[model samples]
Target: MASKVIHAIYTDDDILLQAVKQVRAGRYHIAEIYTPFPVHGLDKAMGLEPTRLAITSFLYGLVGLAVAIVMMNYMMIEDWPQDIGGKPSFSFLSNLPAFVPIIFELTVFFAAHLMVITFYMRSKLWPFKEAENPDVRTTDDHFLMEIDVEDHDVNQLSKFLYDTGALEINLIDNK
Candidate 1:
């Protein structure tokens, strides 16, 4: 297979939208899009599915809550029951408010730590891993659209990008 460079046209939001619309209407293949920040409705425009990270965080928080409850109960009531400040440790149901702080801390701790781990894992980002950045400027103030042209007309694609008011155009070599 012959390796070819994919040219990306960078522009503002309006131009990006126009280019995306035209590409969609023409049924052109879009490789990827890079934006400085999350654009509203861009995911819908790109037909992306919702992220499941929030759900995963909730589940992990629940697990933390369970762990907090089990550990506290086992320590305070079952293994070594202790009476502090005249509060009875006979029942976990009683003085539940007292354990609220531990529960809350654990919930936040587990959710935050686990969610970060999950996000890194899912995104394939790991410690000491080299970051794959498309463009340094794109991280600050640029919108990039990458289109794959498989047996497609390069002139037509270039024209479309130019007509849409692309500020810059560059080709990416994909091996």
Candidate 2:
């Protein structure tokens, strides 16, 4: 079945919560919801699953640290042992301060670049991509909910939306 997109604008958070509660009580299916900023407890009300970005970030950071360690050890110890000013290149255990800059820089480099790549992939937001945002006002001051309902209940859905404190309601047919 095709989807019918609806836009609902709310004045404040309370009205939005009331509308969500009413929809949940009626057992209606909600497709997506957009808000200018996060509404507290909204995820719990919508029954969304926890995000996995944190785990991905941690793993990426660890990989970066491992790469930094191996690269530094190989370059400084085996490949080209530079005896600058008679300073031993065997181990950085004594002159740890000198290695601090490289270690810190590599850690930041890996975490920042890799995490951003992961986030973009996870959100399906690639460079120069256009996403289907139903309403432009949704990014600013409006709260919008896209709901799916039976063909017979299109008018009923509109009426239900208005009664539940929707400032303005509009529908679009998605084939």
Work out the TM-score per prediction: 0.88, 0.84
lDDT of 2 by residue, 15-99 (tens): 8887988987778777888888889988877777988888877787788888887888788877897987787898857546677
Question: For each candidate, C-alpha RMSD in Å?
Answer: 2.2, 2.4
Local lDDT at 20 for model 1: 80
Question: Candidate 1 lDDT, tens digit per residue, 1-175?
Answer: 2254455656577668767877777787777788887777777677678998999999999999999999889988899988899999899989688999998999999999999999989988988998666777778888888778777777877777777677776665677
What's the TM for model 2?
A: 0.84
Error of 1 at 85 (Å): 1.2
lDDT for model 2:
0.80
The reply for model 2, stretches above 4 Å from the true place, is 84-86, 92-97, 150-152
